[model samples]
Target: MSKPNIIQLSEFDITQKIIESLSNVCTRAVLFSVKNESKDATQIAEELKISLSTVYKTLSNLEDLALAEVDKFIISPEGKKIKQYRSRIGKVEITVDNLEPSLNLYPNTDNPKSSL
Candidate 1:
């Protein structure tokens, strides 16, 4: 899989979306889980002890923020395709200037690893 592109969230509209993505505790946990490793949604839920539905919701939010990238799809014996998610954002910087908030994102630099 190709590396995710760096995302800058400094615009007024984008900054709000980024903030909203990281607002939930479950979402933050999901980010931490995939920071240096790729994990399927099931693994994320089990590792974080969060409900699968919550994890899925958080993953969706992160995807919208471009903070989570689909590393690959694993085909199950039943022909089901499972998506492995990795954190595309290696760093997040939030700053407030002139009463306005800005967010800066750094893309993950590490090589992709199997979700095995």
Candidate 2:
């Protein structure tokens, strides 16, 4: 039998990736709430407690990660669908089981018996 290989992420990007994962879930919820409506970048901004531009950036990041998608079109202030930016499903799977919390399942740091 062959042993398994492990790949680790850089300490810097690990945190960023975690933050991105959290942001991903949040964006999904926001999209689901406004599934049938056209939500502007400002709306997402407010909902996410971030700047309008932050919302745009976050959405762009989410889209790039394939965690969400947007449909851009013209819209009117009079409740008209002039140009709507519709959000849709573009989920990214995250397999957590194989990652953190299992790195050192059976440590031999103090295995006195093995010293025999």
**Per-model TM against the reference:** 0.80, 0.43
List ranges where model 1 is wrong by over 4 Å.
Answer: 1-12, 111-116
Candidate 2, residue 53: lDDT: 68
Tell me the lDDT of model 2 at 10. Answer: 28
Q: Please give the TM-score that candidate 2 achieves against the real structure.
A: 0.43
Put down candidate 1 lDDT per residue, 39-82, tens digits, no spaces: 89999999989899988988887876667878889998999999
* lDDT at residue 57 of model 1 (Cα atoms): 87
**lDDT of each residue in 9-39, candidate 2, tens digit only:** 3222343453454456655555443445556
In candidate 2, position 36 carries an lDDT of 53
Cα lDDT for residue 33, model 2?
Answer: 37
Instruction: Note the Cα lDDT for every prediction shown.
Output: 0.75, 0.44
